[model samples]
Target: MPPHPRTTSPPRARRRLRRALACAVTISGVLLTTAGTGHADPYAAPFPAPSMTPSTLDARYATERRSIEQALRTAHGVGDTGRARTLGAFLRPGRRFLDFDPRGRGQAVEVIGDLASARRVALLVPGADTTLGSFDQRPGKPWSTPGGGARAVYTEASRITPRPGLAVVAWLGYAAPKTLSSDVLTDERAGQGAVALHRFVSGVHRVNPAARIGLLCHSYGSVVCGRAAGSATGGAAWRRVTDIALFGSPGTTAWSASALGAARVWAGRGGTDWMEDVPHVRIFGLGLGPDPVSGRFGARVFDAGPGGHSDYLAPGSPSLRNLTDIALGRPESVTRA
Candidate 1:
């Protein structure tokens, strides 16, 4: 009777039974098959994963900047040679210098609009690292490339109001900072640049005294504007500069618009920008005043959406549209979208 206890299943048999149970359970449940398996669901699709690569963003900007620069260059070359030549005259090396010193020749650009009536004029001051090369083209290029953010402003002005004569000028006479370091950012160079800008504005007003002039400053350019506004130079007395528009600005809070004598001041910032998070402290007594976009500053604020730092001139952006409206003096056109 005790020997009968040995009548249990063999190890191989037990293993086989376990394997069979596993197979049955697997077949009864939801099945997943590899790509090569014919049992796989044909309709199941993979999701598009979000990109987390910095290189991808850099490549995107590089491609876009290239395309825009090419288009601008083509447009600049095709226009009436007489006007282009005249504008090119100002864009030359000697004319674009900082000195109003008899030796200092100032640079200028005129974008012609409707001829029937007097028009609004916009003087665009570019930010740091902007050269005649970077003014319209990408950095490190020798030849002037067109269709820069400056040109976009001109185009916007032209399209915004076909009635008022619109003359958009890209004034690159000042030497902008070549980098973003605090040393360069806080140098006396900003004040020097401001002096140059004042002269450029004066020269433009001299040419078209009756035009309603608007000053559009971007980034470090805003610093220049603030400085110029605070200067006591006769050149700052120009009556044509009616409105000052600061976009993607970091400073404006430090100086009062009334002190600068700008009739109207407008400030805008694109949402989701890191600049807003940047400490507003002035370093080495060189950094600019306060944040103009802060409601405490009392500037007419417009929403620039989520384009961040460089979104001001991005095509089809709300910031661009708002800029067009502001340049054209179409206050009603600025919607809060």
Candidate 2:
């Protein structure tokens, strides 16, 4: 018998095949529509977004907390038991929100550390499978819920930050797609998220013009931030960002680093991250484009170590430390890949 062509495929080809196989399984989920989700999101009238910067951080925290408390009362009165409980838990004792919207999968801007005094602020934008229900609950061990992951990352960053003047915000300001849904296939959802994010960033600038802002975009959240980078409310709002960090990203919908239309862009992927295998192909707008970590794509690459799809923000991980260093504008401290 002729010698078998031992593993004819190159590593890149193998990686693409692996990604294709993985995506094929979930592609069916892409067919599911909002109605097909089997549950409709509860709708609440628009709550005002914080526009004017507060004179004091305490005042802003109080304003946000009062709004959330009121929303909690409303939910309880209207028999929205789930949302009410979620809000109640968040309000218990020592939690703070810069913004809160209970309608449609919930929206919250949660702060960790002292935002008012922090010279550095990092906004953590999460990916899919996140909703009001899973925000605080992360019984899933290693894999965190959107809120859970944000909190985990914040906690981890706080531990590693060299300077005490830093804060992290878990900005769940838009409706996220279910992992098994059509929403993940297109940029439509990201477009909406971009608008919200821009507005939120604007609000942040208003509140703390002097504080340097960094965006930590994770997974599908990278798509949202990519959209926001292009759809800036203005040059000033977009310019306020000191760094745009992407981790475990499928793609950023950008052609290159400059294409992101933002400040310095950084990319990282865990050694075990499945994203490494995903094809950076954009097909009929149903796929991602421009792999951020690829040398040709040209985003500053940072070390993210060996961790799975959900482990980049794992507490005490090098990925989290690298992320904190970038957020703190300590580029010299970052461990580059």
Best by TM-score: 2
What are the lDDT scores of the predictions, listed in order?
Answer: 0.55, 0.76
Candidate 2 structure lDDT: 0.76
Scored by Cα lDDT, where does model 1 land?
Answer: 0.55
Return model 2's CA RMSD, one decimal.
5.3
Q: Model 2 over residues 21-57: C-alpha lDDT tens digits?
A: 6677557776665564566544555455445465655
Model 2 clashes, total count: 1
- Give the TM-score of each candidate: 0.61, 0.85
Task: Report, for all candidates in order, the number of backbone clashes.
Answer: 8, 1
Residue pair clashes in candidate 1: 72-146, 72-147, 73-146, 95-105, 119-165, 253-290, 254-289, 254-290
Candidate 1 vs. true structure, TM-score: 0.61
How close to the true structure is residue 120 of candidate 2, measured as C-alpha lDDT? 82
